[model samples]
Each structure stands twice: as structure tokens, then as C-alpha cells.
Target: MSLTDTRCKGAKSQEKDYKMSDEKGLYMIVKITGAKWWRFDYSFDGKRKTLSLGTYPDISLKIARERRDEYRRMVATGIDPSANRKASKLVESIEVKDSFKLIALEWLNVKKSEWVSSHYSKIEARLQRDIFPWIGDKSIIEIKPIEILNVLKRIQDRGSLETAHRAKSDISQIFRYAIQTDRAQNNPTIHLGGALKTPKEKHMASIVEPAQVGELLRQIESYEGTFIVRCALQLAPLVFVRPGELRQAQWKDINLETAEWRFKASKTHQDHIVPLSKQAVEILKAIQPYSGHGLYVFPGLRGDDRPMSNNAILSAFRRMGIEKEEMSGHGFRAMARTLLAERLRFPDGIIEHQLAHQVRDVHGRAYNRTSFLNDRKIMMQDWANYLDNLRKGEDVLPDGFTPLHSMQY
Candidate 1:
């Protein structure tokens, strides 16, 4: 007979555990301790087994019979209900542990060792600010391409189109990592290539004309900022190294006797040598008395332990009425690259080498750092002399500033 609600509520436990059968394989067991549980007994592959439907009052007699019928149907179909339940639980657990945020963080930790601190910081910041809040909790394997596109669209909507594209690339890399680690089946970001708007390329602002360049040189010389900053400003145009490398220059890396400044290139992490010009050496010597004993050549005004802020030179340019669109700290590089090649007529190979740019040979092998050291030394001095003449309102190319004619590039 089927168990009734009144009987289930009023029945007392016996001295031993006993059950009131509901129907089919379903029954309510009343234990000696007065606890009641619902169980379903069934056979699969000639073996008998019991499946706990739930507690008596918690799962009711009607629900117990329904579950029993369901499991019986599974057994009739040559499947075990208990095994299927276990498999579902296993999948749930894996999905929880393989969430997008967790897997992306794991990939970042593994890749951080190969990246510079600034590069790592930028990636981490982008993920935390733009990505993690959107789909971080979702399982990587189940995320659809449309869902990823929504995140990129939001970033693009905010006018950070370039950053949105970069975020997409980062997400793609994370998905690839997930695939390699067996946590994901496909990369949703891979299909989002054409979905985002491409960002327009804007060249860095610079003054390339000789007259404008001369005026800029005059303004830099008369810059009434901190003495250390003034010296750095003076040397920036002459050396034309990356602003970060210039500000982070150390005294130990520079040798006035050899007229060279040697340090690792930040972007490539390769050893780079800057052949110091006569003007550059003079500027360095002038600042030696103040920052010679410190770690950074252009230490911050507030403290000698830290390098000058990256914005120092840029801010100085602003104060001098030079808008960012007119000239940036990095603009010195473009200015030199143009004037050196056009007016001075230096070989492109020598100029590129002096710029510490990565150049490959015909075989696609990277050129050595010192590939054109001797030619660069001559070019460096000539460039510095040209700048001195410009500062004095003289010809852009002085008598000794003639380009090497006989040397084949």
C-alpha cells in the first residue's frame, strides 16, 4: 500500500528500523532514532542497489514515487541513475574550479616571468579594470563568442578602441592558454577579429624643420627648471634615446673617457651602447656634481633614490608653451630620424643602429647590438655638432658635419 500523510505524521518508531512501502521501489524508512528517510531500491545489470531520494518530510511520498519511476526508466534504458548524478556533480566541480578569472590569472602568473614589470602591470591593470568584472566568473569552456564581443563593445563604446582591441588580444591569449591546459574547448575571442573597429594611427608629434628645431633647442637651454632636469633636457635632443632610458641612466653605465653610455634596452632587453657626443659628455659632467653619487642620473627632485617621473620632460615641454601635439619628449627621436636622414644624408642603416631599433638581416636573424658601432660613433659626434650649430642659429650642417661619402651603406 502507498504511505499516507496522516500515517507518516502520526507513526512512531519501533524498537528496530522498519519501513512503510509507498509504491514500486519507493519506501519511507522510520529509524529507531525516529528519523525518516526515503529510499528507492532498483536492479541494474543483475545487481541490486539503493538510491536515496531524500528525507521523508523533505521529499514527500509523491516526490519519492516520481523519482523512483524516473530511475526505473533509466535502468530500463541500460543506464545507472547514481552514476549519471555523480558525473553531473563532477562536471559542476570542474566548471567552478576552471572559471575564466582563475584560468586567466594562472596564465598571467606563468607569463609574468618573461615580461618586464611595466608590461606586466599594464596587462594586469587592463584585465582588472576592463575584463574581470564582465565574464570572469563564467566557465571558460561555455563562454560564447557573442558574450566576449559584448565586453569588447563596452570597451569600444567608452572611446578606448585601441585598449578594447588590446583587451581582445589578451582574452584570446587566455583562451589559448585554457585550451592548452584542457580547461576550454575553443577560443571565443578568435572569432571576434572583425567585430571591433580599428583604431586610427597617429604619429608622435615632433619638429623636423631646421628653423623650428633651432628654436626648440634655444628654449630647452633656457628652461628654468631644476638643474638636473635642465641637463637631461639638454642631452635628450643630442642623444635621442628613449625617454625612459635617458631618465633611468646610471652614472656607472656612462664612461666619459670612452665617451659611451651602455645599458640594456628596455623594449628588447638587449645590451645597447650609446656613443656619447662631445656635447652629451659636457652635459653629463655638469650634472655629475649633483647626482653623480646617486643611482639614477636624473633623480627625482623630491628624492635621489628614485628616477625622475616619466612625465617630467613632457610636463616641462607643456610649461614652455609647447603643446603635446607640437612636440613630446619622444618627439626628439622622430626629429633626429628625419633631419639626420634628410638634411645630414646619413645612411639609414647607421641611423637605425644608433636608434637601437631592431633590424634583421636577409636570413631574418637579428643584427648584433654593436653591428655598426664605429660608424655610429662618428655619426653621434656629427649629430651633436649639428645640434650645437642649430642652437647658435648657424647652418644645420656645419663644416665638420658632412656625411660620410665614400662608405657604402
Candidate 2:
């Protein structure tokens, strides 16, 4: 018989479990442990199945009846309530996996092998600080271009235009990753081209004129700093390497006998060779007694375990009364690049190769790091001699180094 309210209220637990049936396959299971649960039994496609409504008093008789009717309505329409429930759960799981923050983190893990530790940290930090709080929890497929622009606009409002541009690029990469992985339909950031104001480019201050460069070199020689810094300053112009590369130089990377300094280029992720000149060799030898035992060629003042701060050379420049508009530690590169091409008349390709720049060939292929090794070695020594002459205010037009106007390609 169908159940009623009085019968359910007076229902008692027996020695074993028993069920009180209701209309249309709905029933209540009563257990000896004093627990009661609502259950439904039905058939779909000629196969019988069961669905758990919920617990007894918590689901109550009235609610159980209502839910059972709802399921019966669905079953009458040729639907399987149990299968539909499972499908809904699967969709929820997929949604959680496809959230913007989770997918972005997945993309970051895939890129960790290609990026340096510092580069990875910067990307991670930017996402956490700027992107995560904005739309990180939203589904990647649902994120619109306007939402991303709002995040970038926040950064631009703070006057970090370049950072805003970078943040946009980073978001675009994440969205592209989502598209490739089939989690998203499109990259919202792709349509945002030319949306932000371009940041003004600021060139590193440098002394390009030969006469001014000569004066700058004379002052660097007289820098009143630590002995190791003095030696680094002396070698900076001769080698013209990036300041970070110079300060982080290790004795193991230098072969005194061969006059070569080899290390992986931080920006390009390739092996680079810096041909050491006689003057550069002398400076290295002089500093070896002090920093040779440590991992860094120029160890920090506080401890030998760490390399010198990248600002050491710049600070020395300031102390020498060289204004930021006049020269910087990186200025040595600009100075050498200018004079080498204009005064020394070296080919642009050879000079760019010596700078460890990623120059392309006529066919648009990148030249290898070690390209023109022999010519670079010759150029290194000649550049060193030229610096020596400049320090003494001597004529810079050395023989055998023809001007570009008179040379053939």
C-alpha cells in the first residue's frame, strides 16, 4: 500500500532493514540502527535503476515525494536521471580544471624549462600581483577581451605603460595556451592590438664622441673605489661586455692561456665567447689573487659567495662625476659600438657578432654565437690598442683598418 504521514511517523526499526513503498517506485528504507533514507527505483530503456534522494528526516516525506515526481517526469520523457546526474558532475569537474588561474599555472610549468630562474620569477610575480585577483577564477572560455583590458588599464593608470604592455602580452600567451589545449575557444587578447599607448623608449646614456670617450676612460682609470672594482672598471671598455656578465664572471670560465672568456649569454640562452685582449688579461690576472678563490670574478664586498651588485660600476660612475645623461656602466657598449663602426671602420655584422647580438643573415636566419671567431679575435686586440691610444689622446686612425667608405662589401 502507498504510505501516509501517520504510518511514517509511527514507523519502527525491526530486527532487520525494511522499506515502506510510496507511489510510482518511491520508497523509504528503515534500518535497525534507527536510520531512515529516501530512495527511488525506476526503469529506463527497459532497464531498472535506483536513485538516492537523501536521508529520512533531512529529506522528509513531502520533499521526497516532490523529488520522486520530478524524476518520474524526466523518466517519462525518455531520460535517465542517474546518467544525467553523472554528466552534470563531469561538467563541474571540467569547469574547475579550465579556470584561468589553473590553466595559466599549467602554461607556466610547461615554460619553466625554457626560461631562466629570474625570468620565470618575474612572470610568476606579475601574474600573481596583477592578473590573479582580477579574473583568475573565471573560466578561460568565458573571459572577454574587455575584462583583460580592464586589468591592463589598471597597470597603465599607475604610469607603468611598459609593464601594462608586458602584462597584456603575458595574458595573450596564457589565452593562446588555453586555445591550443582545447580549453578555450579563442584568445581574447589577440584582438587588443594597438589598444594601449606605446611607452617612450629611453636609450642608455653613453659617451659616443671620441674626445669625450677618451676623457671618460681617463676618469675611469682614476676611480677611487675598491681594488676589484678598479680592475673591473679598467677592463670594462676593453671587453665592452654587459655589466651583469662582467660582474658575474668566474675564473673557471676564463682561459688565461688562450685569452678567452666563455659563458652562457643570459638574454639569448646560448654559449658566448668574449676574446680577452692583452690589457683584459692583465686586469684579470691582477684581480685573481683577491677573487680567484671564489666563484665570482668580482665578489661582493660583504661576502665571497655572491657576485658583486650590478650597480657597482654605475655607482662608481656617479662618484667620478659622470652624470647619468653622460655615461653609464652599459655606456661602454654603446661607446665601443659607435667608435668601432665609425672610427675603426669595422663591418656592422662583425661588430654586432662581437656584441653577442642576435643578428640575422641575408636570408633572415640567425647567425651562430661563435660566427667569425677568428675575425673577432683580431678585432678584440685592435680595439684594445685603440683604447690605449685614446687614453693617451693619440691619433685613432690606425693603419690596416680601412674606413668603410673605401672598403668593398
Candidate 3:
């Protein structure tokens, strides 16, 4: 007979005794207070072993019989039930493999020290905001080109085509990192080159037309923004260096005695000498009261320690109702370039050298400074005077503006 409650009840009154049921090969051992623990005894590979089956009433006789049958099936299949159960638990606890988010984070961590803090923050923001939500849960190796294209398409749909293009570039870099680590076989982003909408051509530096440039300059002169920025706006076209270089200008870099401003260009990674025009020195002298005490030529509103943001001039342009294509902070360079070459009849080498163009020699490349400094110094003065005339609405002809034929030299 299988275990019956009457049989167990009749015999289990004597506590502290091991009770065996020959009919079912189960041992029902009773503790001193009359609690029953079940044990199953069996022979595996001619060796006898006992497996604990929990306490009685917790694991009922019917449940015990079902568990026994399950073990027997494992034996028939040449599987050890206990070993299989342990392995399954281990597999469940394991994290499977790295997800795209984990891999991307690791990728960022490894390269964090190589990048500036601002660049690090930019990459982190792009990855978290655009890339992570869609592919973070999936493994990096599993991501395909179509999925990446979908992400680009999503950013494009939001009318941020430039951002979409940046996201695509960043994602490609990330996948390339994954490939280097052997986590990914190949870059899926490679196939997605021409799949997305062609990026719209929006000039980073907006330059107004020669005819309208004077009007824009007048608007800048009359702009009623913060005094430091107003002075910066007016000085933009006079110097026409990169926006960062302009804002980060220090008093030490300026030689009022000689009317020359010298600083390192961050983009070209070279020393740049800007021959300050008489007009530029006047503007600087005008703004000296505000920025003279600070480290930067254009200090931020809240502090004297920090330089002004690059957007200060661009925002000023926006307030002047100048579209980005019509005028940007960097567009001043283009304005000076066009007017200097076409209107003022300056040499191409002088203009390019003043602009700090990288010239490749037989050995390598170098930024030539004094290649045409004399003509460039004069050209800068005339350009500054021309801008002043434009701001004053005087009759200034953009007459000497000509395309440079010797850009290669």
C-alpha cells in the first residue's frame, strides 16, 4: 500500500524514531515533538543514496510520489536531476552577456581620459538621449544596419537633420569601438552611408551678402545686449578669428603698443597671430572697463573667471533678425575672406595664411604665419575700416572682392 494517513498516524506516536515504509521505499522519521521528515532512498550506479524530500504535510504524500516519478525520468534519460537543477539556477542568475548600453558605457569609460570634459559630456548626452533607448537592451553584436537607420530616421523626423547626422556619426564610432573589442563582427553603420536623407546644407558660419553686410554691422553696433557682448559683437568682424579664440582672448595676448593680438587656434592646433587694426584697438579700449579685471576678453555675466559662451554672438545675430545662413558668429571669417580678396585686392596666400590654413610641405603640414604678414596687416586695417563704414551706412563698395586663384599656394 502507498502511504496512508491512518498507517502513519497509528505508528508515529512514538517520537525520536526512524520509521520506514517498505511499500514505497520512503523513510518518515519523527522528531521528539512529533514532526515528520521524508527521505527517498535509491540506488544510482549500484551506490545507495538518500535524497531529502522536505517535511511531511509541507510536501504531501501525493507531491512526494510526483517528485519521485520526475527523478526516475531523469535517470532514464541519463541525466542527474540535482545537477541539472543547479545548472539551470546558475544560468538564470548569469547576466547572459553585455547589452549595448553596457558595451557603450564601457567604450566611453575606456576613452574618457583621452577626451576633454566637454567632449565627454557631449558624447555621454548623445548616447544616453538618442542611442540608448532603442538598442540599450539588445547586445551590441545583434544590432543591424536597419535598426541604426531607424534611429537616424527618428531623429530626422523630429526636424533635427544635423543632429540626426551627428547621431549617425557617433553611432558609427560606437560600433567601431565594439568591433575593436571583438564584441561585434563588423560595423553595421558602414552600409547605412547613403540610406538616410542627404544632410541639408546649413553653413555653420553664416555670412551676409556683401551688399547687406554693412546693414548687419550697423545692427550689431546698435545692439543693446550686455555691454561685454555688444563689444564682442562689434569686434567679431574686425578680428574675424574663430569664436572661441575671440572670446578666450587674454590681455597678455594683446599688444596695444603694437596693435597685434596673438593666440593659439584650437581648431587648427597652431599659433595664430592676428594683426589688430586701429579700429580693433579702439573697440578693445572701449570694452576694457568691463573685461579689464577678468581673465577673459569677454567675461560671462555671472562671473569674471569664465569666458563667454560661443553662442553669445550667434544669439546676437538671431536677435538682429539675421537667419543662420545669412549671418553666423563664424561667418565673419567668410565675410572678411570674401571682402579682403575680392574688394581689397589682397593676395590669396595672405588671406589663407591670416586664416591659418594648414599648408602641407614635402615632409608634413605646418601653419605658416609670416608668409604674407605685411600685406595681411594692411588688409586687416582696411577690412576693419570697411566694416566701420558699413556699420555707419556710408557708401562703401565691395569692389575689390575677387576669387583667389592661388588657394593651393
Candidate 4:
């Protein structure tokens, strides 16, 4: 017989715990302390298992029967309510494990070496500010394309269209990484093409004219700042490496006698060689007395064991009456490339390789292979001497300069 609400409610607790049956595995337990509980007893695989519902007036007869009926259907379908509940909890925990934020962070750590430190910081910042708050906890596989579009739309709505595009690209990359690592099934970002406004392409400021570059070099030669910064200013044009890479240069990577600086490229994390010219070797040797003991050749202004400030080189340029529109820290590369190709008559392939760009050689070979280090050594020395002529306001002829190869290191 089915139990009535009044009988269940009026039922008193005895000296020990006891139960009142309702119907078909549904029953109410009345404890010795007068507490009551609703339970469902069922059999799965010929083994009886019990499930908890709730208490007397709190659960009531009507709600308790409804819950019991639901469980009965689950059992008829061969599902154990208790085991199903546990599986759901496990699925929920797994979902959390594969959440968007968790996967993105994992992707970041994997890319730590491949990306420039400044670029890595920007991506991390964008993920935290734009992507994470909205759907970070959502399972990567479950995140829909529309959800990603909404996140980018929010960024675009704030007039950060460029940032929106970058965020989209980053998210797409993250999804691709997730797929590669078996964390996601598809990339939603591929479907999001043309979803955000395209930002105008603005190249970094640089002065390529010979006369202007000459003056810039002259100013750097005469910079009266800290000796460390002055040396940085001196080497910027000669090496023409990325500013971050220049600042983070280590003494261990340099061989003063052999005149080469070897380190991993900031963008690709690939091995790169910068054949130091006679002038470059001179400047490094001078700075060796001050910073050779430290980890970084240009240690930070503060007394920590860190690289020099990212802005140290650029700031020195500004202090020398150079405006942002006039030149930037990255301008040194442009200055070298332009002068090398146009004025110095150097081959495009050699200049491209020296810049550490992904370039295919005349035989369709990549820059990493067929380094042309011997030709590059001569170019470095000639380029250095050309600047010397320009700084002295002399008529610069890059070809007329004596090649360093003729002289032994």
C-alpha cells in the first residue's frame, strides 16, 4: 500500500531507526532522533542498491513519489541512479579539467620559448582581460563559435578592433593547439573569419635616408648616458637584432676572440648567429669589464640579476632629441637592411638571413640551412665600416671598404 502524507508526518521515532514504506522501493526512514529521510531501494544486475531522496515534511509524500518514479524509470532503462550520479560528477570534473582557461594556459607554457617575452606578455594579458572572464571555465570542446564571436564582439565594441582581431587569432591558435594535443575536436576560430574589423597596417617608425641614419649613428656615438646604455646604443645598428634580444644578450653567448654572438632567435627560438664586426667586438670587449660577471650582458638598471630595461635603448633615443616619428628601437634593422640592399649592393638573401627572417635561398632552401656564414661575416664587417664612414660625414661606399675576410680574426 502507498503511504499517506499524514501517516508519514505523524509517524513517531522509536528507540532505533525504522522506515515507513510508500510503494515500489520508495520508503521513508524515521530515525531514533525523530529525523526522517526518503529513500529508494532498487536492484541493478541482481544486486540491490539504495538511493537517498530527502526528509518527511521537507520532501513530503508527493515530491518523494515523483523522485522515486524518476529513479524507477532510470532502473527500467538499466541505469543505476547512484552510479549515474557518480558518473555525472566525474564528467563535471573532467569538463573543468578541459576548460578554456586551463587549456590556454597550458598552450602558453608550451609556447613560452617560441614567442618573444613582450609578445608572450601581451597574449597572456589579452587572454585574462578579454577571453577568460566570459567563457574560461567552459569546456573547450563545448565552446561554440557564437560564444567566441561574442567575446570578440565585446572587444570590438570598445573600439579595440585591432585587439579584437589579435584576440581572435590567439583564441584560434589556442583551439588549434588544443586539437593538436587531443583536448578539442574542432577550432571555432576558423568559422570566425571576417568577424572583426581589420586594423590598418602601421609599420614601426624608422629613418632609412643615409644622411639621417648617419646623424642618428653620430648621436648614439656621443650619447653621454650610463656606459651600459651608450654601448647598447652603439651596438643597436651594428647588430640590428630585435631590441628584446639585444637587451637579453648574455656574455656566455659571445666569443670576443672569434667575434660571434650565438643565441636563440626571439621569435622562432631557433639557433641564430650574429658574426660580430671588428667594431662590434671592440664595444663588447669594453663593456666586458663592467658586465661580464653577470648573466646578462646588459643587466637591468636596478641591481637585480635581470636583463636591461626593454625601454632603455628606446628611451636613450628619445633623450637624444629623436622623436617617435623620426626613429624607433626597431629602426636599426630597417636602417641596416635598407643601406645593405640599396647602398651597399648586398644580395636580398644575405640581408634577409642576417635579419633572422624565414627566407628561401636561391636553391629554394630556408635561411636556417645554408647559413652563408662566410658571406655574412664579410657583410657584417663592411656594414660596420660603412657606418663609420657615415658617422665621420665621409662619402660612404660600402663596396670600397676592405673586406674583413682578408684579415684573420
Candidate 5:
């Protein structure tokens, strides 16, 4: 029988527990103390489970029937109401799931494996330095396009337009990756290309002129920077290897007798042999006394095992009053590429090969190994002496020289 408020007074003093049906599966349990509670029973996967609805008048007969009927409707659709209830409660507990910061970190961790050590450091630095503090905590699914634009605008306001653009692209990639993995629903950066200001095109960097190269060589000769770095500056234009490969050079890779410094270029991560000139070997010999015992040919001042700081050579240029745009440590490669092929009339293939550049042939195949090594050995020596004589103000330009277009810079 259905119990009413009026009937409750008559049964209030009963000394035994009894049942009052709210619906088929849900009922009121009236206890010996005349206290009333609700209970629900259902089967899932052939196992019966009971759920506590509520106490007394709190879950009234009417409300208990409503909950019971809702559970029955869910069961009719082949869904387990009990499991859904548990899942809903668990989801409520984690209200911040699929957040931007969470997905970004997951993205970084997954991509970290594919990157080189230096690249990993650069990407990690970008995320930690710029993106994390702004919108990282927001749920990625909840973040709108305007919020992403706002963060990028803030980065531009701080005078880092390039970084802002890069960061925006990186963030877009993260979102896309997240979508692929089902961590996020949408990429906020898709519409950002039109909303953000377009970046100006940047030109390829090259030196000003061969004369300035001579002047810069003179400045390098006079630079009172770290002894190791002074050697690096002297060798930079002569060898014209990538800046990273130069810094990471080790003594084991060089044969002073054979005049060969063989190591893997960082960009290609492939073995390359630099046929050192007498001047280059001499420069190596000078630094060997200080760093011969250490792993790095140019060990840093602070540690024996560490490579010389990447900034040491560039800082030396700055100390010698070379402006950033006027010249750079990497600019020496430009200096050599221009002067050797244009001024000295070295073959194009020989200069590019000596530059350690990955040149693609007309058929899209790479250079046959050792195409320029023998010639480059002579060229490297001649290039060294040519710079030395020019620094001393000796007229070293070939007779009847009409400077080629590249020879100017």
C-alpha cells in the first residue's frame, strides 16, 4: 500500500521494520524506530546491485518513483544505469580533463623522442618561456579562438613578433596532435592565420664584402677573447663548417699529421672530413696544449668535459667592435662561400662541397662523396693565406680581377 503523511502518524509507533513501495524496483524501508529510507535494486551483466536513493521524506515517494522510472528507461535502451551513474560521478570529479596545459605537456612529451637534444631544448624552452603561463590551465575543449589570439597578441606586445608567430604555430600543432589522439576537440589556431598580423619576409644572411672579411679577420686576430674562442674565430672562415659542428669538435676527430678533422656535422648528423690546411692545423696545435686532456677540443673555461660555450666566438666578435649585423660567427661561412667561388675562382661544386652543404643534383641525388676533398684541401690552405695577407694590407686579389657578383658579399 502507498503510504501517505496522514497514514505515517498511525504507523509512527510501530516496533518492527516494514516496506513501502515507491515503484517496482524502488521502495521505502521503514525501520523499527519509525525511520524511513529508500533503496533501489537492478541487474547488470547478470549481477544484482543495490543503490541507496535517499532518506525519509528527503526522497519523497513521488521523487523516488521518478528516479526509478528514469533508471528503467535507461535500462530499456541497453545501457546500464548503475555504471553510467558511477561514470558520471567520476567525470564530475575530474572537471579539468582535456585541459590545454595537460594536452600541451602530453604533446611535448610524445614529440620529445623525435627531436635532437638541441631541438628538444629549443622547443621546451619556447613552451615554458612563452605559452604555459597564459592559457595552459584552461580546458582545451573549452578554449575559444579569441583566447588563443589574445595570448599571441600579448606575446607580440612584448616585442617578439617572430616568437609570437612561432608560438602560435607550435600551439596549433599541439592542438592538432591532441585532436589526433582525442585529447582535444578543436584547433583554436586554425583561424589565427588571418587574424594575426602577417610577418615580414626575412632575407638570407650574407657578408658585406671581401674587404670587410679582411677587416673582420684583422679584428679577430686582435680579439682578446677566450684563447679557445680566438682560435675558433681564426679557424671559422678558413674551414667554414656549421657553427654547431665547430663548437662540438673533439680532439679524437683530428689527425694533426694527416691534416684531417673528421666528425659528424650536427645538421646532417653524418660523418664529414675537413681537410685542414697548415694554418688550420697550427691553430689546432695551439689549442691542443690547453684542451688535449679534455674530450672537447675547445673545452669551456668552467669545465673540462664541456664544449666551449656557443656564444664564445660571437662574443669575441662583439668585443672587437663588430656589430651584430656587420658580422657574426656564422657569417664567416658566407665570407668563405663568396670569396672562394667568386674571387679565387674555385669551382662551384668544390666550394659547396667544402661548405659541408647537402647539395642536390639535377636528378635530386646528393653529391658522390669525396667529390671536392682533394681540391678543397688546397683551397682551404690558399683561402687561409689569402685572408692572412689581406689582413696585413698586402694586395692579394688576382691580377686583372673584376669582382664577380658573389665576390662583393
Candidate 6:
């Protein structure tokens, strides 16, 4: 039977600790010192476990039974109530300190594997330089929207509107993470969205006209640079991957026989596949004798351990008479996107996958890297053949397509 208040109050201390039984393994032990303690014993996974609910009078019979029922329900569902309680205590301890910096660092630690190293460094630097100095030690729960706005205003005050926007996003991310972890109730950054000034748009300079593209391809052939850089330049137009991804290409990620270069995309964190053309494969084969020993396809001049410097392609562009206003290392992507969309009239959905940009399925079904793999392989070969014809100064425009020479992108 459940212990009533009168009986529990009337129970006296025994010669030694003795039990006053209640229902469902809940009971009270009266010690020789007149101390009363409530406990619950239950079998879990074929092993018995005991839990100290609390002392009587301090806990009261009703509250102790309620806690017992709650914990029993947890165990019935295959949950370990003891381990769950310990985890709750840990979160509570962290919540008590409530340091925004501590929580933000926790968030970053959880997020480090998702972001590329370069992108992760930028985010860490932004938080350290802009947000941490002002409110690092402050309680995240108490940080008002106005306080967040002031921090963003300081970033904007220094003419960094873009950084201000990024800071706002970082703050929101932390607040949401805090909410998931039972720390913050609301996100302050959500209220300050329309308050900050929007930064101006910028697009990378690129040559998209077919004739100009042909001329640019011819100029690439005449490059008198290092053989490593030369091979990189040759493959750039064919693959049209981001400069960073191109330079950081690893040998293990490539399959020459299969004609594919697979890697994790730096921007979207997606498993991206770049189908290599015969020409691209040939360029890699040619450079294999020199750089095949290193980790990166394009190893830095300083050492074989490091990939080529970020500026290597930019410096090579300048030396080849390619001005920033005319074309950049990133411009190769824009060039490919334009020609593929306008000249080839390839489906934007297929092109988007090749560009490693996220696109949802029309039916909202699940899809993976190999989605539309055959079409992309065909497009890759077509693009390679197109570039070769352009470099040869041939007007090999396919009939029934948009005129390529007049339009500018």
C-alpha cells in the first residue's frame, strides 16, 4: 500500500536502519539517528538498480511518489533514468554559468566538422573580433535585441556592413543552439533583421562571350609558367571548379579510369562529383610525373606537403595579361555557368548540380550525388570539346542554339 502522511509521520527510528514499504518499489528507511530517506528500487535490463529520491518531510510523500512515477515511466520506455538525470545536471551546470562566449565556443565545437577550415576560421575571427569583446561574459538569456543591435552597429560603423550581417547570423545560430540545449528561450537577432543596412551586390568579372572565351583559351595555351601551374590552367576551363577546390584537389579523390574527381564541396558541404573529360584526364596524366608524389594535385612551390597558395592562380592570371576587371580565378565558374546556360541550353537543374549548388527535387524525394550522373558526364565531355574548338579558333556553334558572339554575360 502507498504510505499515508499519518503513518509516515508516526514511524519511529529503529535499532538500525529499517524499511517502511510503499507501492512500486518506493519506500522509506528510518535510521537509528531518526533520519528518514526515500528510495526506489527497480530492475533494468535484467539488473536491479536503486535511486535515492530524497529525505522525507523535506521531500514529502506526494512529491517523492510523483518523481518515482516519472522515473518509472522513463525506464518503461527503455530510457535509463539515472543517466538522463546526470545529463540534465550537466546541462543545468552549464546553464548556471550562462556565459555567451562559452556557449558560442560550444556551438562552434559542435559545428567544426560541418565547415571547411578556411570558412571556419573566418567565422571564429568574426566572433572574437566583433562580438566577444562586448558581451562574451554576459548571460546569453539576458542579452536583449537592443544589445545585439549595438554590437552590429559597431561593425557597420567601421564600414563593414557585410560583417555586421554575418555577425547577426552567428548570434542567431548560437541563440537557436542555446534553445535546443535548454539555455535560451528566445532569439534576439530575429527581431533585428530589418534594422541593419544591406550591403551592395558584387559579381566577379568574367568573359562569357564565345569569341572572347576562344581568345582567352588561346592566351592560356601561350602561358610560359611553371608546368604545374600550366597544367592547372589547362584543366581550369574544362572542370570549371572553384579556385580553392581546383588547387586543393587530392590524388586519392580522383579515379582516372572512371573519369571522375569526387570531393566534399567547400561551400555547401555536399559530396560533389566533378566528371573529368578526356582532355582533363590527359592534363592530370601529364602533370602526374611531377606532382604525383605529393598529396595535392597542385602542390605549393614551398613544400610538397602543402597545397598551392590561394593566390597562386590569381598571380598566374595577372602574369597572363588577365586583369581583375576582365577575369578572375572565380570567373571560370561564371564563365562555365553562362555558356552552359545560354549557349548549350542545358537544363539549369542539371547545371546547378555540376556547379555544386543545392537544388531540391521537384517531387521532394530523396536524391544523392549520383543524381543525373549520366547527363552531367555527357555535359562535361561536351564542354571539354567546346573549349578545344574555341582554342582552335573554330566557330563550331551547334545549330538551333542561341547566337553566342553577340550576347554578353
lDDT of each: 0.84, 0.83, 0.73, 0.83, 0.74, 0.84
Query: Where in model 3 is the C-alpha error above 4 Å?
Result: 1-98, 106-122, 176-186, 204-211, 248-271, 314-326, 356-371, 392-409
Candidate 3: residue 379 lDDT (0-100): 75
| Candidate 4 lDDT, 1-409, residue by residue in tens | 7898779879898989997888899998899999999999998767788988977788878999999898888667545567555434434245486788776776676577666577899999999899989988898899999999999999999999989998998998989877765677899888987877788888889989888878888898889999999999899899999988899999999998899999888776678999999999999989998999888888987863888898898789889989888888888898898888787777777888889888775687666733789889989999998998888887567656543323332
In order, what is each prediction's RMSD in angstroms? 15.8, 14.6, 18.2, 13.9, 15.9, 10.7
TM-score per model over all chains: 0.71, 0.69, 0.61, 0.71, 0.62, 0.71
Give one digit per residue, the lDDT tens place, for model 3 in 76-105.
544444544443343322253546776666
- Model 1: residue 391 alpha-carbon error in angstroms: 0.2
lDDT of 6 at 13: 88
* Tens digits of lDDT, candidate 6, 1-409: 7789998999998788999999998999999999899999987657788899989899999999999998898677555556555434534345436678777776776577666577789998998899988887788898999999999999999999999999999999989977876677999888986899989998988989888999999888888988888888889989988889999999999999999999998788779999999999999999888989889899989998888888877788899888889998889999999988777767877788898988777677645789888888878887888887788887585322332233321
Error in Å for residue 344 of model 1 = 0.7
The backbone clash count of each candidate, in order, is: 0, 0, 6, 0, 0, 0
TM-score of 1: 0.71
**Model 5 worst lDDT window (10 residues):** 400-409
Error at 225, model 6, angstroms: 2.6
lDDT accuracy of residue 304 in candidate 4 = 35
- Candidate 3, position 234, lDDT: 79
Write candidate 5's Cα lDDT for 1-409 as tens digits: 6656555445553567887664467776778877777888887547687777787677666777788888777556544565555434533234565656666665665566566467678877887778777777677787888888888888889888888888888889988866765556778788877776777876435574766766777887888767888888888877888887788888899999999988877767656788998889889989888889889887788898777888887778678876777776677787788778766887676787777778767788887547657677777777777777778766386333432323321
